[model samples]
Every structure is written in structure tokens, then in C-alpha cells.
Target: MSEPKRMGRMGRRPGHGPGGGMMPGEKAKNFKGTVRKLIQYMGKYKIAILAVLTFAVASTAFGIAGPKILGQATTELFNGLVAKVSGTGEIDFGKIGRILLFLICVYAFSALCSFVQGWIMTGVTQKVCFRFREDISSKINRMPMKYFESRTVGEVLSRITNDVDTLGQGLNQSVTQLITSVATLIGILIMMLSISPVMTLIALVILPLSGILIGIVVKFSQKYFVAQQKYLGEINGQVEETFSGHNIVKAFNKEEDMLKEFHGTNDMLFQSAWKSQFLSGMMQPIMGFVGNLGYVAVAVAGGMLVVRGSIEVGEIQSFIQYVRQFTQPITQVAQVSNMLQSTAAAAERVFEFLGEEEEDLTAEHPVKLENMEGRVSFEHVQFGYRPDQVIIHDFNCQVKPGQTVAIVGPTGAGKTTMVKLLMRFYDVNQGSIQVDGHDLRDFNRSELRENFGMVLQDTWLFKGTIMENIRYGRLDATDEEVVAAAKAAHAHRFISTLPGGYEMELNEDASNVSQGQKQLLTIARAILADNPILILDEATSSVDTRTEERIQRAMNNLMKGRTSFVIAHRLSTIKDADVILVMKDGDIIEQGSHQELLAQHGFYAELYNSQFEAA
Candidate 1:
């Protein structure tokens, strides 16, 4: 929930250890970090925690002590009544009635505490759940695009929903309940010894063997449950991949291929889940066997004592009740163990996600730019998605302030990588990127990103009003500013025709709207941002000629006096660029204005010719 950790490079690069290589997942066993993160949630609700513990302890005491009192009262009454029947004394029902009243009071108090436990824990758990989800959302937002590219949306959703909700019983209730149950067991054991030590020992002999069995089940279950959670994540990934690309599946007639992948994931999940559940399922029968054996011991030993006149009948009854109390809590404790492990596995994943590297926030203090000129330069910058396969090696380029620089390149020419580095989504492996003569790293990630606006090929809009989507560019934008930005992006006319004008609610991903409209909305966002620098990544690829021309006019108005970097396969869009860099295979092969490149008739000329020829 606290501001995410800033990018730290003092030690090794992230996702690595002291070995200077990728650390395997199981070897480090960093589950403690996960446990600590969860337990920290308890801090905010200290008063609720205290209240739950108090009620649980009080309830346990009544549950344990009340039975013993009733037992003594019965023993005394039966012995006294027997004497009276033999004409030795008179019966005392009044004393017995008081014992009955005491038992009723104890039951009432225990029930009330149980109610309090449920009520307080409900509030505590719901609050923790909300905080946990909110912190995760914030964490994900700050993570670089690398994280999302590496993980599917469904796998992420599992941690937020399934994994998080598992804590409801295990996290909030188990702590208090486990403590209370253990205390109750101890109290019962001590009281049983009072009636007859030999009997108590005989009754308890089965527990050690039971503990061994429980331990074995737990040890194996932890391994299997961890596997189960992992497989679930895999299955979630498969589902996300299939559904998100359902259109592609149908278009390419890949339903069978998709189904095969789904079946593989489904089978793995089943095996993992069944193995984990089978181990846990064994606990109940084993617990029942141990408990029933205790019953046999108590009956045999208590009968012996009675025959020897060592204890009265009622004392024997009290011991039986106490035996059930002690052993039944064991069953509850075992169940708690099972749930806690599952919850911990989920917590590990959730905390692991929250610990991802975030955008640098150290430069909370920034010098405001009074007059901005958008000059951008990359000097000997090297970068990659993976450590081994470098995408951009020793790349260099320069743009004068307020100049339009267009980059034309084949696929994987590092055209997109160049823009990504310029935006500082991923830091370069070598050299420096500078803006206005200052190193980009020195400006802080947030302050640096805020200086530029970007429009990508694919557009994303939330399920909200159209006005809300455009206003995302500047959260504090006025209604008039939003309308003006929309007009500049040539979006206002289409928006006005909608039933609700700018207030129309869009579907998920804005799928209901035309692709061009979505692009316009994204452009409106950029227009509203009005930053001194802009990067357009194939902004016109998804639009028609008419729409592109309209957006081009809007972009020209937006780019005046601001540096703009445009990456396009369509050469027409870059014709007016002051400088065009033609890249191939991670290297810049030519650099000049459009006419200058065409005159030389090299890589840029070929690339330009190919695009129009294909069309």
C-alpha cells in the first residue's frame, strides 16, 4: 500500500541473485517476505484483532471449565442420593438445580462470544481484502510493460480474486481460533488429570501417533498444494489466451489447436488439485480413528476406576465430555492447517506481484519547465526484453528541438524499442538518453514520462463515458477542455452523433465503437495532454484515409513547436518529417529527409516503394 520501491541498481539487476544468473524459484524459498506482507495487514485493525482474541479466549474457557463443574455436581448428587435411599441421609435437588443454572449461564456466555467472533472478524477480513486488492492494483500500474508481457491477465486476476479471498477464514479467523482451541485443549487435559491421572494418560496415548500422521499429511500437502496453485495459474493463463484471441482462433480455424492447449492445462490442473485434495481428505478419517480410540480408552479406564471405588459415575461422564472437547479441537486445528497452507500459497503469489519494480518516484521535487522545447537524443543505447537476445545494440539517434523525426523500419528493426526507450519504460543497457542536455535518468520516471504524449496502434478505453476516456490525459481537465481536445482530434463530430454525445458509455475495450473512433479518442487523450513532446506509433494504421487525414491535421496542430517522433510502415505519413531514419536489422542504414532518402534510392526508398506496391 505504501509507495512502491524505487528502481535500485546498487546491487545486481533485479530478478537475479548473487550467482549472476537467474535464480531458480524453489531454491531461495522467499515465502517469508510473502507472510510478512500479509501479517502487516493486521496492523491496521489492531482493535478488532484484540476484540476477537478476547472473545475467543473467553468462549474457550467456558467450553472447557463448564463441563467439569457439571460432572462434580452429578457425582456428588448420585453418591448422596444413594446414601439417602439406603436410609443414611436425605437428597439435595436444590444444590443440583444451581449447578444446572450455572451450566446454562456458561452456555449463554459461550454462544455470545461466538457471535462476537464472527461479527468482528467479518469486518476485519473485508477491510483487509479491500486494502490488499487496492495495493495490488497500484503495484501493477507502476510495473514496466515487461511484467504484463510476461504474464497473462487471467493469471493476474486469480491472485486478486481467488487467492485473496482464500484468506477470509485462514488469515483472520484461524489466528484467534487456533489460539483459543489450543488453550481449550490444555485446560481439558489439566482437568482430566485431576479426575484420574492414569485414565487421562491412557486416553491421550493415541494423540502422539495421530500427531505423526497429521504431520506427514501436512508436509506432503504443502508441496502438492503449492503445485495445485501453480497449475491453477497455468490454467488461468490458457483460458485468458484462448478467450482474448478467440477472434484469431475462429479466423485461422484453430479451434482444435486451442482446444488441445486447453485440455493440456486442464489435465495438469486436475492432477495437481486431486493430489493435494486427496492428501487433505485423508486427515478427517485419521482424526476420527484417533478420537474413537480415545473414547474406548476413557470407557475402559473409567469403568475400572468405578469398580475400584476410585471415582464416582459423574466424574467418569465429565472425563468423556472433556476427551471429546480436546480431540475435536484437534480436528478443527487440522482443518485450519490445510486452509492456512492454501492461503499461504496464494499470499506468496500475491505478495510476489506487489514486490515488482516500479517507476522511480525519488524525484518528488522537480523544477517546473517554464518554456519547453522537445529535443530527444539516444546515444549508444542498448536494450532488450531478455538478457541474452539484445534487440537494440549500440543504437544512436538525435533530434533537434521542435523537429519531427520519423523512423521507418522493418519489423523487429527496434522501431518500437526506440520509442519504448525514449519513454524510459525500460532503461538502456549502455549509454545515455538526454533531453534538453540533462540525462533522462536524472529527471525521474514520472516527471520524464509526463513530458511526452503517445498514441499507439491499438487503443484502449475503459468501460466509462467517452468524456471520461479523453479526460484521462489530464485528470483535472475541465469539460470545455475535453470538448476542445476532442474537436482537435476530429472526434467531436462522431461523438455528437452518439445518443449521449460525449457522455455515452462504451463497452469493454470500447469494442462497440468503430476502430477509427477509438483511435480518435486515444488521440484526443494525447491532444489534451498537450505535452511538449509526442510519439505516434502507427497512429494511422487502423484508420481510413479520411480519418487519417483528419487526425493528421489534428496532430499537426498538436505537434507545432513540440518535438514529435513517428514510427510508421506507411511512408506517406512521414513525407513531411524534417528528418527520417531508415532502420533495418537493429541498425540505422540511412538518414535524411524523405526526398533526400528517395534521391539516394537505398533502404528507405525500397521500404517506401514496397508499402505503396503492397497497397
Candidate 2:
């Protein structure tokens, strides 16, 4: 239960590799499939999405009409000036004023439409994010223990946090922008063509050139972007590992080696990042150059048309404005393409997690054995964490009600594995584990677990008061009961001496307290649970001899009428057990009272002798 070992089993981010980092805009392997899945997931929000799309189109259409409408004002002003110059008519100031006011109203209405769509889209995105998080949380509880053991904690958490968040933000932006970009492109094209199809054709020449340039930049930069993301994760992992194990590195005098490793990772990250940024950066300027060429060509073509009376002078101004507006949507489309990839990647991860194999907690004809007396039996149980590697073989054991069974073995002797099997954390590959003559699987997993209490070597305490932490064992337990359990576990005395007594709040990880204190809190939790069956795995390992003695006395009282399985490394703790089972490799080598096992002079005797010899 060392810190690093605990972290390896359940670390928060586990470095910035697959499980950590936002990793925005990453390419998805199955882009089309993922997008299809996302659309299916979002099907319930179709109405809201449709509203957003409608409003987005309306906003773009209204925005597109601004330049053309203003062009009308320009035409009116030009006509008035020509008339005044020719001394035929006075300038129509009132008409020009009316036209300007109408243009303002149109722009204002467009802004309003944009705001309404954004608000609606944001709500939809957040709702989708909320559902994703809820589903992931629920999915975790239904998942098999093996699934968690086979992956890092961060990897699972990434689906709920990073992936969902990325999906939400990308969804909010990409959907609206895509709709607006396409709408704007279409609306602008029609307006340009309406004014002068010849000049519109001239303006359209920028598309292929811009497309080729953008395609080349994206093609070259994509690999670098991927590499940059990879090396960034690697470098972050190095930094996290180094800092978390700084003391170990210093103790081993490996500072130089750590630094060298960091330098190597950092250099690679730098190379990829700069190259990707430089190549992607070239996109805007290149597009702008091509656009400027198109603008110049359109300007020349419009002027020729204007001189020949093919189009009006004000029409030339409107066409130039349309040309400028045209390139923006194309740029947005390119940008949205990258965003969609990111959205697809994030959505894919989330969908993958939600689609994982879940444990079948539902038993069709569940055995309802109430008032369980805790008679347990492991009949020819065989199991392994992996299918190909069987660890426990023919692990047969039986314990009557209200008996203390002590399992003693070396580190890799399948001691903990048996406890896990009994609890149904994992099912036996061969044979069955039964409780009160009923197969473990016959009962619902939750109902089966409700009859047992567990206190492990590795203590876990959330950020809460000592009373709350203890009361976690039984949510409805009163304050007096919590305090009583704490006293039984010998944690009350230390708790009372603290600043807030039983009301003292523990920090995250509970590092504010000593290891022994944390262990005592967990023991208190188990005691408060008051279950019919108890499993204690090296529960007293963290405490000193004096505190251990006190807790042992309390444990003796607590186990008075309950069936208890005590898995211990320290042989002295289980001397008074009703039966001592000594396991070696996988099977039990000997089973008897402590005195009887000592008389056998076998593996258990050797193990007991070695501990005293070392002491």
C-alpha cells in the first residue's frame, strides 16, 4: 500500500498520455461512424437543433442583405448627385436617410437572430454534456471490476470530463458556425450573381486557388500536429512522473537521468509544435493573397461592366463587398473541418466508453435469502484476473456461522484473490462460491454485498468531517453510533484531541492525518456498517503495537457473533482464530488451529519463523 503503488493502481491523471489532457482537434479514426453515432445520440434534441439551424440561416441571410441594401443607398446618393450636377433635380436627402435607417434595422435584426440561436444552441450543448456525464457515471458502477483494473483511472475519467467537455464546446461552436458559413456562402453568391453574374464569376476564381493552397498547408501540417500532440503528452507525462517521484529520483541519484529524459521529450515537443504552428500559420496569409487577387480581378471586371452600362457604379461597390464576404465562409469551412474532427474524436471516445461491456447485475430468479447467518463455502473455486492465466486452483474452504477464519500466506500467494472471489468482485472461472447454500451469482450483487463489511490496507477518505466519513458505512447511522464505532476502532481518542473533535474535517486524501489514523477511520467505518460478515485485509498493518493491541481487542468484541475472514501477514494477530488456513501458491496447504499448524512444521511454520527471525 505504498503511495506509488496506490497511485499506479488508481492515479488521478496518470501522466498526460491517453487518459489525460484536452487533446483538442485530434483526428478520429472512425470519423463518419462517430459522427453518425453522435447524430443518433443527439436525436432527442432534434427540435432544438432545427430551431438553431433555422435561426442561423436567417441571421446569415439578413447579414448578407446588408451590403446590397446599403448599395441601394449608395445608388440613391449617386443618382441625386448626378441630378444636382445636371441642374435637373435636387438631391433626395430624405430618401437617403430612409434607406440608411432601413439598413440599420436589418443589421439589428440579424444581431438579434444570432443571439437567439447562440442561446438555444448553448442550452442544447450543455444538456447533451449533462447526459453524457450522467451516463458515464452510471456506466462506471455497472462495469466489472476487471475493466477498471485493466485501465488507468485517468482514461476512464477522461471520457466523463475531457471528452465530454471537448464535445460540448466543439459542438456549440462548429454546428452554428458551419450553418452560418454555408448559409452566408449561398446567400452571398446569389446576391453577387443578381448584381452582375460576370463579376461574380471573376470573384469565384479564388475558390480553387484558395482550396489548393489550404489543402497543401493542411496536408503537410497535419502530421506535425499529430506529432506535436503525441510529444506534448509524452513531455507532460515525464514532468508529472518526475515531480511525483522527485524524492525517489534524488534518493537514487538519478536527477541527471531524469533531466536528460525530460530534455529529449521537450525537444521533440518543441520541434513538432513549431513546425505545425508555422505551417498552419501560412494558411491565412496564403488565402489572403489569393483573395486579394480575386478582389482585384472582380474590381477590374466590375469597373469594365460599369463603364459599359452593364452594371451601376454602386453595384461595383456591392460586388467588392460580396467578394470579401465570400472568402470568410470558406475559411470558416476549413476551420470547421478541423473542429469537426476534434468533435468526432471526443464523441468517439465517449461513445466507446458508454458501449463497454457492463456487468450483469440483474439476476433473473434472484435468491431472496433473508436473515443470512453467513455460512460461506468456496467449493473447488478456480480463478485468475486474466483468462489465460489461472491463479487460484481448487481453493476449497468452508466456514460455519459465527466462526473466525484466518487466511495466512506470503505476498503472491493468492490471499487477497480469495477474498475478492468471495465478495464476487470477480467470478470464479471454475466452480462456485456459495453463501448460506446459495450460489453467489444467484443473488443480486448489491443484495449480496449488503450483508458484508470490508476494511482494506489502503484507506480511502473523502473531504469530509470525521463523523460523516464514519457514517458513510451506514448512511442513516446517528451521531452517537458514529462516535461509538470510532471508540471501538480506537480512533475516538485521537479525534477528540484534534481541533474540531469528531467534527474535524479531513482534507482530500486525508493526508492531514497519519497513516494509522486513516486506517482507524476505515475500521470505524466497517464497525459502523454492522454487517453480518466481515473481511479484514491487513487492517492493523499501519498501526503500532500498542494501538494494534487496542484495535485487536475491539475487533474481538465486534466479531463475537459474526462470521469474520481475517487475512493477515502478521501471524501473531490470528492466533485465537477458530481455524487458520495457510495458503501457498494457490491452494491451502494446511488448515487447523495455530498450535496444530505449528506442529505440522510446513510452509506456514517457515513463514512464521522467518518473520520472528527478521525481527
List runs of model 1 lying over 4 Å from the truth: 1-54, 76-91, 114-150, 153-164, 167-169, 208-286, 343-359, 363-367, 379-396
Tens-digit lDDT string for candidate 2 (1-615): 011113332254434334574566778999999999999999999999999999999999999999998888888888889999999997798998998999999999999999999999999999999999999999988988888777777777678878898899999999999999999999998999899888877777668988988889989998999899788777777777788778899999999999999898889989999999999899889978988898889888877887798988788888889888899998898789989998999898888889999887868999887688999998998988888888888889899999999999988889988988887878889999899999999999888888989988888788899888898899899999999999999999999999899888998778799999999999999999999999999999999999999999999999999999999999999999999999988889899999998899988888888889966
What TM-score quantifies how close candidate 2 is to the native fold? Answer: 0.95
Candidate 1 residue-wise lDDT, 1-615, digit = tens: 001112322222222212122111222245566567677867888888889888988888887878788997888798788989899976678888888898989989988997898788888888888888899888877778787656545456656776677655457667766878788878788899988999888877878988999889978877777777666656655665577677888999999988898798788878888998999899879888888888888899899999999988998899988887777777777666656666667667667778777777545465455665777788988777888988777778888998999998888899988887787777788889989877777776777778888888867678899999899899899999999999998999999999899999997657779988888888998899888898898988888998888888888888889999999998998899999988887778899999999999898888888878956
User: Stretches of candidate 2 above 4 Å error?
Assistant: 1-22
Model 2, residue 44: C-alpha shift (Å): 1.9
Model 2, residue 151: what's the lDDT? 76
Judge candidate 2 at residue 450 and give its lDDT. 87
Model 1 scores a TM of 0.82
Top TM-score hit: 2
| Top candidate, metric lDDT | 2
Q: Which ten residues in a row have the lowest lDDT in candidate 2?
A: 1-10
